[model samples]
Each structure stands twice: as structure tokens, then as C-alpha cells.
Target: MITKSDSTTIKSYLEDSSNLHGGHADKVLIPENTAELSSILIECTSKKMPVTISGGGTTTTGSRIPFGGIVVSTEKLNRIISIDKRALSCVVEAGATVDDLQSACGKEGLFYTSHPTEKNAFLGGTIATNASGARSYRYGPTRKAVKRLKMVLATGEIFELRRGEKLFTGRGVSFGLPGGRRIEVALPSYDMPNVKNAAGYFVKDDMDLIDLFIGQEGTLSVITEAELGLELKPPEIRSCFAFFKDEENSWAFAEDLKGKKEWKILSVEYFSENALKLLRRKNPNVPPASRGAIFFEEEGEEGQRYSAADRWLKFIKTRGGSVDDTWVAMNEKDAENFTSFRYAIPEAVNEIVKASGFRKFSTDIAVPGGNFLEMMRFYKDLFRDDGIRNVVFGHIGENHVHANALPVQGAELRRAESICLEFVKKGVSLGGTVSAEHGIGKIKHMYLKEMYGDKGISEMVMVKKALDPGAILGLDNIFPKELLQ
Candidate 1:
């Protein structure tokens, strides 16, 4: 294991994309492979030292920032074990970046559906949070794509789990540790949110054992390697940008577009007036007379692609859009530009927050379709009433919208925090998830109880103790610090 203990080196691993808070650590470890990583974990656990797993340094929830003890970065174990075209799957080290995996798979005529804005993110981090991106509207989250995983316990025991290989029998799960000891973990009796939730441990009456580790936010074990399922590259991908009169109208059109079952929509992304304003600063190609925009992509046969494109053009025009104002990316280069246009929104927001010297107060709330419009309206009114600058965007197709508040002053930051809590409560009350894609790290751990009631939390805590008797892995993440007491 390569370890760094100097103050300068330790500080480099303290912050992430969240910019909400920074962490301090005594040492940092970058292990080359699972064996080296396990040896380090064994020593740390023996001393009851906290271990924070860092993956690509792109986490907005502080999961990558070490609170204390030590930080372990998985940037070195980035290797593609294999890409079996016949099975339509790829095996990779957890540290391999999203872009690396996608590009490698692309060479084999395959596709990786969960392409989040940050292509440099580690696959292990995505699996840790069970990340879902724009294309997830059609492909689902990382949980759906993962076929198998190899994990190492804090005590240096290694275990490999394959999807559907083990099923919960309602009693619990049993496994043999490396040192002649056996560990059996009981399932949490909590009911998970029906929507795209990445809040806490995945639980059900009879769940797959592999699922228990997929979205646990690194609390259960350290994911070392994974085998991910892939899809054949689409024969054709048609992209279009449709600008609407306002935020409400854009989502209204989104509802209608998704309702059309034959569209074969690959992704339906939303951008509010504020988000568009941010993007326009960097790229002037935004359509005129637009308060909001919806960027959508569809995949189908040549005939089907033409048919879908025609239907989209007609729908946008009938909804007050013009054919000339719309932008089409029929080729490869144009398609890449459209992607930059969407990702630019977040990049701009981060820049603004950094310059203003304030913490980011972004809420990752998602409600069911029945309550999506109401939730959007609620968010807009809350920000407006409080006089806070905000931007709304994300996967509106699944009713999951991220309302990001950019506050400059300290008082404004406090109000932004309060509003975030208010909106999260409202989202939960209306059958929504407190977190749609971002997992509850140290910053949002308190909201876990609201997501799952007292009984449910107790069940979850019991499972946590069973798996991590020492609570050394991802200490103080997902669950509040008081839970440790």
C-alpha cells in the first residue's frame, strides 16, 4: 500500500464536488489491487480506525471525503478484465472510470446505458450509490446493469456475489469469513420508496442478496470488482432539443411525451429557465423565445427513428414550438455538443458557488408522476418567496427533478438549507424519495429517518450491526452520528 501522511497530501483528499463541507484525515492510502487494499483495511479495523472509500472524487454527497482516520482512493485498480461480446457483458475493476468502460464497450459494439454527466466517475462509485442518469429513464439504474461483484470486508475477508445466486429466505444471509469465522446478516424490514430512490439500504421481504450491497453507500463492504451487463449499441440515436415557453409548459409537454407508449424515448431531461440562463452564458446556441428546454433522445430502426422524429416535431409545434427554432443532432459531432449543453448547467452552478464562497444547497427530491407538477410548482414558489436564486433540472420523465439553490450570503445559505428540508419533507409526504440518485452521505444522513420511520430504521440499524460489527466502513455516512452511540 502506498500511503501519504503529509499535511499537503492529506488536504488534497479532503473535498469533493459537493463543496458543502471539507474533511480532515491523518493519512491517505492508494492501494493497487484488492489484496493490498484488504491488508490495509485489516490493520485499520484492528485499530478501530475509520476508512473512507474515494472513487473518482466526483461525489456531491461527501462520500469520498474522509472525516478522519484514513482515505483510500481506488484510482489505480482501473482495469477492464474482459468484454465478452457473446454474453453482452463486461468485467471491470471498480475503479475504472465511466468513460473508460463505455468507450471500451463501444469498441465491441455494445452500450452502457447509465451514462451520467460526469463520465470520469468511477464505476464503483456509481454502484455504491446505485447511480441513475438521464438514460436511466429507459435503462434503469446501476443496480439493473450490475451482474456480479467482488467485495472485501473490513476484516480482510473477500467474498464474491453474483446476481440471482443468493436469495433472502426471510430469515437472513450467511457467509464464511476468511479466518474461519462466519457472518450472517439479517435483512432490514423497511419498505423502500417505489420511485428512483438511492436513500438507504435496499430491502424487501425476499430480496436478492446482491441487491443488499449495490446501494448501501459503502457501509456494508468495499466493492473491488464488478461484472456489468451491457446492451447492443442502438442502430440509430435521434436527438432533439425542444424549447418551451416556461418551466410549467415544458414539464406539461414532458408528461404528454412520456405518455405516448410507442415513442421509444431513451431519455427525457429537463432544464429550467434558470438552468438555461446558466448554459447560455457559455454557449449562445440556445433557441430564442425559450424559458425552458427539454433535451430528448430516441433509439429505433431507421423507419422508426424517422417516425419518432416526425411525431416529436409535430408535438412540439402543437405545444407552441417552432420547427426552425429546434436543434437537431443527426450526426456524431452535433450529438456531443448537445450533451455538453446539458452538462454545462451543473458546471456553471459549481463555478458560481465556488466564486461566491458559499456551500451548495441542492435538493435531490423525486416524487411520483401524480405529484410531479405540484412538486415543481411547490419548489418554484418556495425559492421565489424566499428570494433565493435557484435552478431546476434533471430526470423529469421519472418525476425526479433536482432543485439546486445558489446562495451568496450566509443568511441566504441558511434559508436555502431550510427550504431544502421543507421540500424534502413535502416530497416524502407525496410518495416521493428524499434522494432520487444521490445517496445519503454525512451531509444528508439525518433525512434517513424521515425516509424510513422508527421501526424501519431500527431494522436497518440491526442489519448494519450484523454486517459491520465495528462500523469502521464509511463511518458516520448514511446514518447520523448519534446512531453510532
Candidate 2:
């Protein structure tokens, strides 16, 4: 019962995201509930119209909007249905923002540890990408946090999937037709890696069936609601920002810090010279002597343990690492300010790219701790030689780095992409992942084969076909469609 005006309004709304890519849908639908969502999908499937589901529209991968057909938005379905305090879990509608859930959990002295950068990103979107952040090194990613999900299949059937159940059968793959008729098909399952994967279908024989929906990016099914695990907040929290003169010193310091069994480091983030310059420009009040900064968080008995900021300075002094400045967040207000500085890089880069009329792309890669420094040295020289001005930063604790390429358009952009692909190939050869935290959306689809060999990718395609025979959901998102075509 979507009117023409309603479609127009929905289309307009979908276009109002931070999406730089300009792929648009012909029609849009806003479903108020799961029933309404199912109905919309039924009609779309009958018409063979492509369908894409969106949450916060913060996806950089062009996963939120398709080239044509209908776009279903779960924005209005946002709600925290219930919190099972005894089980330490919360049930929430798909569109509920991370901040919204965090606020609700804070009321009961609990916390959901999955910390994605965007506060406004929806819970379902986080699940779709298996999103993680600096805290992931300690708390793990969204897959570990999600316990259950209520998802809608391609055939407009609703299925409730739990952590320990099977995923290839039941209501998940079969939909009741008109006059009590039933249609059945096998649901494909991929061999999901046990590590932090946010690329494509996660498949594994002994894996939790619930994980299939955790990072599918709404291709196989649309997640309507989910139950996520929670934990009590740490008793005491403190953060330290340390500045280092060179990458070698920073790596040595991080290794030394890891060796220290006394302190529990929640996150150890690394920033390159370019990233430090951007931070200094954004916050003129902060000194610009820092070539790199590491944010360390710890918890312990008050007054008994050395503060993270104090330890950071001590470590730098002991190692003769030139220390430009240090900042300590002992209180909530200070912590908020420090996090703001860290998160501002993405926004700042986007704005600069827009102003310069150039396209920007981020290359997120993860290498082994032993090879991280070497890889950085290689890429730094590579980009420099290629004349690609960029910024490099990421969660060092997890051995992931976000090498952001600056504004490049048309031929230049294509050239940069080639360079990036070469870099990714090199990373895989060196025992690293092409994608660290960011899922392999349209941007990185070409490199999917390089990361996962032919056998691995063939298994992924088989799963996609089994779950979505029509290929209606987010087509050509993670893996290139030409291969399937």
C-alpha cells in the first residue's frame, strides 16, 4: 500500500546519507514492521525487481543502495523490545542505533562492548558488517556479541535463528505459498573463518548458525531483530595518548607494552605522520610534534597502579623515543574529547576530498605483528613513489591499518586502485588480510579472489545461490558478479 508520494519521499530520504557513490534506486519502501517488510519483499520478488535494505546509510561500500528497483528501509522499525538482564542480553529492532542501545544498557549498569566508529550506525548494519573497533582486540567483534536473529528470507518467509542451531533448513529456506502450499530449497552456508571476518558469507561446519546472518550484509536475508549479549562495565577506566618520533620506536614500544603482564591494554591505535598532521590541524590547541600517537586504555585498583598516561611517558623515556606530548583521560569528559579527536580523521578526510573534487578510497589491511612494520615501510615508499598522497592509521593492537588514498578522479583513481590491488596481493602473500575490519563491499570486490582462492570463493558463490537464487539482494556486493555470470 505504498503510494507514489510515499515512494518519492523514501527515495529522497535514502539519498541523504554520507554515501559518496551515486548509485540510486528506482523505487523505495519504508516498512513499519516485519509483516510490512515481508509484504514489500513479496511484491518485489514477484516483479523481479532488485531490492536493497538500508539502516543508517553510513555504509561506504555502496551496499545500502542498488543501481535500480526498490530500496527497503528499516529506519522506523527502530526499538529496543526487551532486555533480559538475567541472561545479559538485549532484543532490539534492526534500525536501533548503537548509541541508543548503549544509553539503554547504561541505565542498568551494563554495556554492549562492540564499538563501531559511527554512533548513528544501526544495530542491524553493525551485524551486517560484523563491525568492530579499537575495543575488538579485547571484546571481539559483533559476531561474538550477537546471540540470535529474526531474519526474512528471499522468498518472503520469516525465520528465527539462534546461536547453536542449523541454518540450511527449516523456515529459513522454505516459504508457505497461497492455499497452504509449501516451497523448499536448500540454504547455502559458507565456511566462515574463525577470525575477525566482515567480508562475505561466513561459513563453517561447526560454526554457530547464528553467525551466518551476523555479517551477510543483508544479501541472504534481512535481519529484522536481534538479541545481543552484554556485559557489566569495567569498574575503572583510563586512557593514555603517547607520541612517538618514528614507526620503529612505536612498534618497539607496543611490543614492550604487550610484554608487560601488569597492564591490560584495551586498544593500541597507531597514526602516521599524515594522520598526526590532520589531527593537529583539526585541533589547533594540541601540539604538532607527534609523528604518531597510541591510545592505551587500562583498568585497575585506583592509586595502586600507574596511570596509563604516566606509563606511556615512562616507556617512551626509557626507550629514548622522542615524546612530543601526552594526554590522559581519567574522567568521562576527557575521554569523550580524546575519542572525538581520534574519530575526526574520517570526517576530515571526506570533507577535504569533496572540497578538492576528487574521489577518496580507504585500503584496510591486516598483517601479522611481526610483518606490520615491514609492510608499512613498503607501502609508505610505494605510495610516495607513485605520487599518491594519503593518510595511514588504524588499530595497531589488532595489526590492522587503514591506508586512506587522497582525492583521485577518473584515470588517476583507476591507477590508484591498481596500486592498491597490488598492495593487497602482496599483503596476502605476506600472511595478511586484504580487508581488516571493513567488509568487502563493492570497492574491494575485485580483490576478493586474491584473498580467498578459487575453492574458497566457489564455496561462497554456491552459498549465495542457494540462499538467494534470484540474486536480488545487494548484487555484486562482496564478490564480482562477472564470475557468477
Candidate 3:
């Protein structure tokens, strides 16, 4: 493990995708294996040093940012231990990136559930936040796909856990940590949202203990390895981009497609007019008459693929979109291009945020499926009269659309912050989640408290205290800085 205080390396390691926030670190360590990881943790614990466990730095939240202590990176621990094609599962070291795992699955004609092929995102980080992408509408998030996980706690307690290996006793599951100490985290009293969520802590009645670790954001333990369940690749996957002259109609069309049982719809993504403009800036040849776009993919057998495409064509035309305007991708290269086009919207927005020299204040809130239209109407009505240059796009199938407010001036940036918080308040009021994919990392800690209130926060704190008695893991993460001390 490298422990030198190289400013250049420490600076690079302390920043994540949430370029808006960063922290100070005196040192950095890249552990190559769990033994090394445990030893490092033990040393840090003895000295009472705050240790930040950084998997991949692609975190949109500031969870990876170290406040005062050394940062422990999982970069060197990347190794695909084994792939059981027959069982459709793969065991990987915590440092293995999402791209690496997906490529390995592709070689074997298998698939991992999470489609977030961001090269920098590690398998451990994905599990840390229970991250989900567009395909989550059909395949759920990382938590649902996880089979088993291994972790090294703050006191150097090394343990491996599986989903069904333990049960609750009306108190909570307990574990014998590495340092010969027992850690018992009782189940929290609060229930998670019924919709998609990645908030502070995951708790439920008779919940599997694995659920707590899957989305614990390193506040519970530092993930060292994981067993991910895979599935057989589909015979044929067809993609389509349907553009609409009016943005509202695209939302309606998306809602209608949700009821189509004939086709195996994998995802339904939405792109707004301003989002389209951002895409054009990044790629000139987007499409003609494309004020708003609906990107959907259907996976099925060869015969069903074409039939799904035909149905989508007819539906788009009926919804005021021309058949010629729709882009269909049957080949692999075309499919890649279609996916890239969908990803371009966010890249373009990030560019806008960077050029403006302001920290991005993107909203990642979600409402219950039934309250989607209500929340959309709220956003449309509020932003329609306002002068904020915002673009809304994301996993529309789950009623989680990200509103990226591009505020150029300083005052506008502050206004964007308030606007995002207000949106979170409204979403939580509708029985939704303050965070959909991104967890309540350092930046969204306040929103987590706002959504859950004092009693809820206390319940989470109880769990935190149980797992990390020293409060040595992930300072300034989901819990408040004050809670750590």
C-alpha cells in the first residue's frame, strides 16, 4: 500500500464525479488484497485515524472525499476470481471495474444486471450505493442482483455474508468481526420507499442482513469482494429512439408503453427539448424534428424483436411522430451508437456545468409510479414560467427523471440548489425518494435528514454506531459530520 503524501496523487484521489465538492487527505493507500486491506484498517483504527474507502472515483456524491485521514483505494484489488457460467454467477474483487465485469460476461454470453458500463465505476462502488441505470426498470438495481459480499470493517473485522445465511431475532443479526469483537446492528424502525431508492440506510421487517451492506455507502464496512448473479443473454435486443414534437406527449407515450405485455421492454428513457439541445451540442447529427425523444429497448427472440419494433413504430406515429423520424438499431454497432446517444445528454450537461465554472446541482429525486404525473406537472408548471435553463431526462419507466439545472451565474447556482431541495421535498411528500440512483453521500446528507426527520435519522445513527463503533469509516458521508464524533 502506498502511503506517501504526494499532493498530486492525493488531490486526484479526493475528487469524485461530484466535481462540486472535494476534501483534504494527508495520505492514500491502495490495498492489493483483503489481507492488506484488513491490516491497513487495523493500523488506522489503532491510531484513531479517519479512513475513507474509495472504490471507483465515479461517485456523483462526495462519499469518497476524505475529510482528514488517509484514503484507502481498492484500485489494486481488482481481480475476477471466478465466473460460474453454469450457475450464472461471478465472484470479483472489490476493485474490478464495471466495464471489466461486463466485458467478461460478454465473453461468456452471460450478463450482469447493472448496465452502468462506466469504465471508472467499480463493482464495489455500484454495490456501495446500490446504483441502477436505465435497464433497472426491467432488472432492478445492484442490490437485487447481489448474491454475496465480503467486507473489512473499521476494526479490521473481515467477514463474508450471503443473503440467506442469517435471520433476525427481533433484535438484529450479529457478526463476529475480524478483531475478535462482536458487532450487532439491530434493524432500523423506518421502512424504505416502495419505489426505487438509494438513501442513507436500508431497513425493513425481516430484511436480509445483506440488504444493509449492499447500499450502506461504506458507512457500515469497506466492501472487499462480491458475488454477482448473472443471467443468460437475450437472443435479440432491439432499440428505438422515438422523438416527439411536444414534450408532454412523450411522457404520455412512455406511460402507455408500460402496459405493453407482448414485448419485453427493458428500459424507457426520456430526453427533453433542452436535453436534446445539449445532445446536439455534443453530437451534431442527433435527428430532425426532434424536440423531445423517447429511448426504449426490447429484448426477446428473433421473431419477437421485429414485432416489438413494428409495434413501437405504429405507436410513435399515432403519438404524432413520423415513422421516418424513429431510429431503429438491429445491428450491434447501431445499438452501441444508440446507447451512446442516450449517454451524451449527461456528458453535454457536465460540459455546460464545467464551462460555467460552478458546481453542478443536478436533482436525482424520484416519486412513486402513481405520483409520477403529479410530480411532472409540478416540475413543468414551476419551470415553465421560470428563467432557469434546466433539462429533464433519465429513467422515465421508474418515474425518476433527473432535472439538470444549468445555472451560469453564481446567484443562479445558489438558486439551483434551493430548487433541487424543493423538488426533493415535493418528491418525499408524494411518498417518493429523495435519491433515486445516487445515494445520500456527503452532499445530500441534509436531504436525507429532511426526508426522514429526527427520529428516522436517529435510527440510522443507531445502525451506524453498531457497525462502526469508532465512526472511523466514511466521515462526512450519509450521516452528519457531528454524528461521527
Candidate 4:
């Protein structure tokens, strides 16, 4: 293992995409292999030193940011172990990036469907958070793709957990470790919102033993390697940007797509009028009159692609969307452009947050499909009444969207924080999750508490303490470190 104690070199490991500040670390340890990582954890646990697992630094949450700890960087453990074509699965080291995995899978004509929008994200981090992106509308999140994991617990115990190998006996689970040791813990009793979520621990009746570690936000153990399932790539995908004359029309267009099972839509993303304004800064091609837009994709035989486009055009017109101004990607180059357009919104939001010198205040809430419109209206009314600069966009098909509040000044930042709490309460009240994809890191602890009350948090704390007895891993990630004591 290579260790760096120089403060200047370790400074870069102090922050993530969340724009959260004040992270401090005494040093960073780069482990070359899983055994090296295990050794490091063993020593740290004995010393009672806090250790934070460092990934690609692409998290919107401050999960990787160390408050005061020795950072364990997984950068050198970047290796693709194997790709078993027959089994439709690939094994990779923790530091391997999503882009590399996607490229490797692409060469085998396979696809990693749970890839987040950020290509630089590490596979381990994505798995740790149960991340999902646009295609998740149909494919679902990273948890569904995880088939197996090789992890090192806080006590230096290494174990390989495969799907279906062990399951909860009601709200409790037992795992046999090396050297005849066994770790038994009761799973938290919380009814996880039916919507897309990554708030706290993934708790359910008779849950898999592997799933307990999937979204623990690194508080439970360090995932050193993972075996992810893959899907056969479609022959071709048809993606389009359908611009609407009104924001409500865009919502209707998205709702119509969600209701039509025969449409076979792969993703249904949305952009509000304010979001379009941000996009217009980068691409003047955004329809000048468009109040909102929906970016959608579908898969079909190459011969029928044109017919599908025609059908989409007719349906868009019926919903009062702009047929002539619609942007469709029939070729690879066009598809790339359309994908970049969808990603640009988050990039733009990050830029605004950086300039404002405040942490990003964005809601990752998701409600049931039936209550989506009401939630959308609540967002619009609350943000408008507050008079804050904001943007709304994301996976509309999952009834999940990110509402970003951009605060240019200190007062606006305070108000933005208050508004975000209101949004969280409203989301929970509507039977939704406070966090849909982004896991609760150092921030959003209060919002998590809103969804799961004090007793629920205590139940989660029991799971954490049971797994991480030293409380040396991922301090203040899902919950405050004090709770561990």
C-alpha cells in the first residue's frame, strides 16, 4: 500500500459533487489489491481510526468526503477480473470506473443498464449507493444488477456474498465469517417506500444478505469487488427530444408514455421551462417557443425505426407538443448529441452551485406514479411562492425528478435549504422517498429522519453497529457519527 500524509495531496479527496465543504483528512492510503485493503482496515479498526472509502469523487452526496479520518483510496485496485459471457456477468475490482465497465460490456455485445449519468463514477460506489439513471425507467437500479460481492468488513473479515445464498429469517440475518466466526444482526424494521429510493438501509422482510450491504452507504463494510449482471445490447435505440409549447403538455406527453405498455419506452426524462432556459445557454437549437421538453428512447428492429418515429410524432402533436421542432436521433452521432443534452443540465447546475459557494440543494424525491402530478404541482407552487432560482428535470417515468434550487447569495441559500425540507416533508407525506437515487451522505440526515422517525433511525443504527463495531467506516454518511455512540 502507498500512503500519502501530505495535506496538500490529500485535499482533493475532501469533497464530492455535492459541493459540501470543510472535509479534512490526515492522510490517504492507496491499496493495490483487496488483500491490501483488508489489511489497512484491520489496522485501522484496531487503532479505532475512522476510515472513509474513496471512489471516483463523482457522488452528488458527500459519501466519500472524509470529515476527519484516514482516507482509503481504491484508485490502484482498478482491475477487470473477468467477463463470463455465458453467465452474462462480469467481475471487477472496486476502483474500476463505470465507463470502463460499459466499454468492456459493449465489446461483448452486453450492456450495464444501471450506469449512472456520470461516466467517471466507480462501479463500487455505484453499487454502494444502488445508483440508477435514465434507462432505469425500464432496467431498474444497480441493486438489480448486483449478483455477487466480495467485501471486507470493519473487523478485517472478508466474505463473498452471492444473490440468494443467504436470506433474512424475518427481520434478522446471519453470516458465517472466516475462522469460525459468525455475525448475526437484526435487519431494521422499516417499510421502504415503493418508489425508487436510496435513503437509508434497504430493509424488507426476508431480504437477501447481500442486499444489506448494497445501499448501506459504506457504513457497513467496504466493497472490494463486485460481480454485476449484464443485459444483451439492443440492435439499435431510437431516442428523441420532444419539445412542448407548454410545461403541462410535456407532463401529459410523459404520462401518456408511462401508461402505454406497448410503447416499450426505455427512458422517459423531462425538462421544465426553467430547465430549457439552462439548456438554451449551451445549445441554441432548443426550440425558442418550447415551455418544456421530454427526452425519450425506445428499442425496435432497424426496419421499423422510421415507423416508430412517425407514431411518436403523431402522438406528440395530439398532446400539443411541437412536431416540427422535435429532435430525433436516428444515427449514432445524433444519439450521442441527445445524450449529451440530457447530461448538460446537471453539469450546468453544478456550475451554478460552485459559483454561489453553497452546497447543492436538490431534491431526489420520488412518489408513486398515481401521485406524480400532485407532487409536481407542489414543487411548482412551492418554488414559485418562494421566488427562488430553480430547475426541474429527471426520470419522469419513475415518477422521480430532481428539483434544484440555485441560491446565488447567503440569504437565498438559507431559504433554499428551508424549501428543500418542505419538499422532503411533502414527499414523505405523499408516500415517497426523501432520496430516490442519491444516498444520504453527510448531508440530508434530517430529511432521512423525516421519512423514518427516531425509532426507525435507532433500528438502522443497530444494523450499523452490528456490522461496524468499531464505527470506523464511513462516519457521518447515512447518519451522524454521534448516533453510533
lDDT of 4 at 280: 98
**3 or 4: which has the higher TM-score?**
4
Residues 128-165, candidate 2, lDDT per residue (tens digit)? 98889888877888888988889877767877877776
Candidate 3 residues lying further than 4 Å off, grouped into runs, are 178-180, 303-306
TM-score of 1: 0.96
lDDT of each: 0.83, 0.73, 0.83, 0.90
Query: What TM-score does model 4 achieve against the real structure?
Result: 0.99
Best TM-score goes to which candidate? 4
Q: List model 1 lDDT by residue over 387-461, tens digit each.
A: 788888888888998898888788787788889888988998998888889888778865677788777667777
Q: How do the predictions measure up, each by TM-score?
A: 0.96, 0.90, 0.97, 0.99
Off by over 4 Å in 2: 1-20, 167-195, 301-308, 321-324, 408-411, 482-485
Native-referenced Cα lDDT, model 4: 0.90
Error of 4 at 309 (Å): 1.0
- Give the alpha carbon lDDT tens digit for every residue of 3-64 in model 3: 65889867878777777555888889887778889898888878878888888888777788
Q: Write the per-residue lDDT of candidate 4 for residues 193-277, one digit (tens) a residue.
A: 9999999999999988999888888899989899999988888888999999988899999999988898778999999999999
RMSD of each: 1.6, 3.5, 1.6, 0.9
Where's the lowest-lDDT run of ten residues in candidate 2? 186-195
Give the clashing residue pairs of candidate 2, or none.
190-203, 191-203, 192-203
